[model samples]
Target: MSMLNIPLFFQDTAAVEGDMGMLWMLLSGILVFFMQAGFTLVESGMTRAKNAVNIAMKNFLDICVGSITFWLVGYSLMYGDTSNGWFFWGGFMQGEGADLFFQTMFAATAATIVSGAIAGRTKYTTYIIFSLLMTAVIYPISGGWQWQGDGWLTKLGFIDFAGSSIVHSVGGWAALVAAFMVGPRIGKYVDGKVLPIPGHNQILATLGVFILWLGWFGFNGGSQLAWGGDDATGASTVVLITNLAAAAGGLGALITTWIWYGKPNLAQSLNGALAGLVSITAGCGNMTATGALLAGLIGGVIVVFSIEFIEKKLKIDDAIGAVSVHGVCGAWGTLVIGLWGVDGDTGIGLFNGGGAAQLGSQAIGVLAYAVWAIVLSAIVLGILKATLGLRVTEEEEIKGLDISEHGSIAYPGKRQREFEE
Candidate 1:
């Protein structure tokens, strides 16, 4: 039969479906792409003005280098064809051009997250090496288990709707390890007490947070992979829940910080917004709006305590609160499914009637990512520390990396002049 003989209903419906799906994916991609700018500003704003150029440069370079690495090897390892499900080295080494594009963006995101943690003191060369290794090796391997079609984790029924475990947690663990190995920023700790290292520009930092929140729509929405059919409905729900969570997160953080510090802290509130976003990432599509709000609120509250505990007690120097915002919140988001997934054929929430099965899965996934990312990041940073050296010299650290590494200042010709008393 001639192709023109085909029924118009089927052909038109298929074309419409394809077009809608493509539109959704493209929009989502644009959203995720914008996050790079958000990251750049956030890192620059949080660090000292003296090293602003260096911080921005590291973020820029990571996207470039990380993108290339993922294209060449990372995507294949993570999502390429697999036979036995788990372990190392998947058979699908080369990704289709379309899939590669999406995967590359995610890989770059993981690489950039580390820049904030190791800002100010690390050598530029060392930073590049770490970024390349993380995207090309560590992140891809871990991502395979959850997102890969034939990976053991996926087969084992593990779920991460967005990337709480795959993306944020991986970055968090790496950041934690890097900060420990690189040691605290100069004078960040003195007399056995942690000192506050206030960000240089709160306005810039807040602007960056807003950008990140805007970009998250794409981050969670795209994960739905819906273009038509029932998937489109699910995608819309994801977007709704994501926004609700972010709103709840901001409010939760604002209230808690106001109470704890006896004032409304802009920085903590901003962090709360991010915490809510991260907490809902893993289960946005699965949970209801109310579930998302509660998850975000709890995530905001948890981040406040986690940040203080890690910095004050553990003595870890996380310059911009990456560990708490990404790591702790990411874990909470992933596990929230067990506590709040809608009941029925899908599953039951803990509050409703669910047991520990799903929660246990979340814990295992968390443990797997935490151990792998921390151990590998430590090894990579430790090797760099011993060989080419991870940190700039004490003089450079004190003087700032913009001049020491880049030979240019972020705000040129603004040097402060000192007069003898």
Candidate 2:
């Protein structure tokens, strides 16, 4: 049932199902909002102590800045009356404010994903501008291509259950371009070799991972967008597969790293869990339990290799592995739907006799998102690079963004001497 048919207004009391969906969606949006805290903690904990305040500020402002801009422009671009084209101006839309709030959270998430990629050295002013642009223009326009009722991709039957390719991969592609434009963190690459710059707070990072895990329940679950009868049952099933896949992904990463590096690393394990979550998101509604597990396991292993490849070969400096966990794994989840999605009113995977057609559809959708997101981000960041500059000066970077950018330190007493030294 299309949300358009559901009467969400209180005056339309006949629509009990819409009311249930509204409640469920509100709960889910609240949960996803908590993910900002998770992203903040992870970004801060993973980077140097000197930049913790800067990272925190970026995450917080992503929500504050992202919400208002998306409200004013992004929602209409995504969910308004769209033309039947690849790109359409959705125009200023008026709908349920509650639904708008739910989508705004997702917009914030897409913008926030880039924060980790360009963590250490980006200018705060430049970031704020980019965040607003991304939510108001980049993300929403791309989103319109899929989610809008009259968009071309929807006509072509591209499926993204909860935005694996739509939200996560869009952010990933932008991150890839933005990180390339910003350059790596200072000392990340000296001479020819890629050096390891481990995060400062593993415990805090671990806690952040746990919080993200909890929030994903809402992320994937509420995406069902309905609540009565079969919708409720399906939502519970989605929650189950989501949890199982995450577990499997963590285990897969743990075992792979243990076998390859000779130890089970916590950071890799946490990333693996996230990898699984991203991997399963596109197929959460249509996949069987076994399929979800396999997809997640594949996602976990894929992130390990993808991270190394990006670091060593591509030489992209992603501080928190956002590119691998969200971008690479998100693509996997979307593609896997072509391989194993159930046949019904929902979707039909190739493995279930849907044929190569679905796989072809998935590929085109992923490629389209990559090209569109990367090109737009590169253009925006390139323009910014030529004018405002992307990275901080060497002296400011050495002093830390917290002091250089914000004139304050996250841990003034303990780190002041070390920073001076």
Candidate 3:
């Protein structure tokens, strides 16, 4: 091999690796984007039959608006050099910018989770406005705290590998605020009795869960940020841990609900699986398989009680348990990293002999996100409530959001007035 050929070979090799990374991002981003379909199916299927159209509409619009908004604004805010305040130096023009493509999917996801929690009774225009703001402003600014160069939270050693607290928790907290501001669906609670308003189609919700579970491979795996050489080992290992945690979570929730309610509920089991995924997300890159399994089991159990506590005690009407599954479980996942992180760098689990420093950092990060999301979301929804209103009129709500908001019904024949709100 001549020296001239050696130089050319190395150049070609670098180009090939970069191109492969770009392909990985493109494919993974698409898979993550498909999770929108999963969200739509799950949310629409779990809610009452009459509001299915409204739920599906909100989910679809979230991705459309969120993608455009993130492309326009969110990306810069999230990864830019923070020395310039809100205006960062980085643009989406450098390198492959596969990071931009991938992050856009996540931005949309963070915004869309709110749609499920406040389903059935919100105004359509309000949703559009808030979705835009969430993707463009709220989610991005907070995301910068941990991810962007010169981020304060990053300086503090806060670790969120793939956004358990950053993405899911933020969405959850916002969903809680939106649900509270909008108030419960008509007749959700009457005379201190919590009524059960089951969804129209259970099969659809199950399928949605399956789709989301499948998409998670891309969600967590693609976060490795590379596809060259040794990157494959890390990516594959992360995927394996993700799967193990999910399976553990499913079983944990199934067993708990079965013991408590005398029957294992499928819906809860599905959510348990999701909880496990969320719980392990922050630590997946650093955790042992055993650690991930433990986290998943714990997350599954927490979600059941968390759902009940939010519903029965807090009286927040989260129809899809977004607050519990994502918010509560997200915090659990983020904290678990402090306990299971073992990349020989970031994790300092107290029980694992790393002491309280990592735990403190993790707690601080968690609290910061929780406070930011809750306060900001409450303010946004509050202003909306005071001005154009938050919830629909009782008449509209009872008639159902699909017909009232969209002037159409999801099912043409099943629009019978058999049950009254």
Worst 10 residues of 1 by lDDT: 412-421
Candidate 2, pairs of clashing residues: none
Return the clash pairs for model 3, or none: none
The runs of at least 3 residues in candidate 3 whose Cα sits more than 4 Å from the true structure, single-residue gaps closed, are 1-11, 82-92, 228-233, 344-347, 413-421
Candidate 3 residue-wise lDDT at 101: 77
Per residue, candidate 1 scores C-alpha lDDT tens digits across 390-412 of 88998888778887898877776
Q: For candidate 2, which ten residues in a row score worst on lDDT?
A: 84-93
The per-candidate count of clashes, in order, stands at: 4, 0, 0
Model 3 residue 286 lDDT?
72
The lDDT leader among the candidates is 2
| Model 1: colliding residue pairs | 21-227, 81-92, 85-150, 85-152
Ranking by lDDT: 2, 3, 1
Candidate no. 2 TM-score: 0.92
How do all models score by TM-score? 0.92, 0.92, 0.93
- Candidate 1's C-alpha runs over 4 A off are 1-11, 82-95, 229-233, 343-346, 416-421
lDDT of 2 by residue, 12-85 (tens): 55466677788888888898999999988888888888889999999989999888888777877786653312
- Point out the higher-scoring one by lDDT: 1 or 3: 3
**Which candidate would rank higher by lDDT, 2 or 3?**
2
